[model samples]
Target: MAEKKANPALMKPLTPSPELAAVVGSDPLPRPEVVSKVWDYIKKHDLQNPQNKREIIADEKLQPVFGKDRVTMFEMNKHLSRHLHS
Candidate 1:
């Protein structure tokens, strides 16, 4: 049996857009780390909607990154993708 290896693409560092940098910093980071940092930022600022855990309430720093004032957890990835590049 062969051991499974991590996906290189997933580990490759990606540059974040300026808007995203406001929350996740300017340093290049992997996708998972970017998502983790975004979550950390959201948690730090208490951006998640209390009425609906699935919704994220965007703050000033996140407005450009998220485009709108609020976004569903599922839509966050789509928005983040627009702000990330290899």
Candidate 2:
């Protein structure tokens, strides 16, 4: 057996755009941490659609990042990608 190591790419720090900063904060973070922070924001703000938990309703702070009023959870990563840079 061989020891497994975390992927360096996954550990790389990325800068967030201003819109993303509104929810996730203005700091360089790893992709996982960024996602975690976004989830925290979503939970804190109760942004998940009641009828469909898979959907997220954008609030004022998230509107610019999502560029739409609603998005599927799967689509969230795409939107977040546009707001992050290595």
- For all candidates, what are the clash counts? 0, 0
Model 2 residue runs over 4 Å out of place are 1-3
| Model 2: per-residue Cα lDDT over 65-86, one tens digit each | 9999999999999999999998
> In order, what is each prediction's RMSD in angstroms?
1.2, 1.1
What alpha-carbon RMSD in Å does predicted model 1 have with respect to the real structure? 1.2
Global Cα lDDT for candidate 1: 0.95
Say what the RMSD of model 2 is. 1.1
Question: TM-scores, in order shown?
Answer: 0.93, 0.94
Compare the candidates by TM-score and give the number of the best one. 2
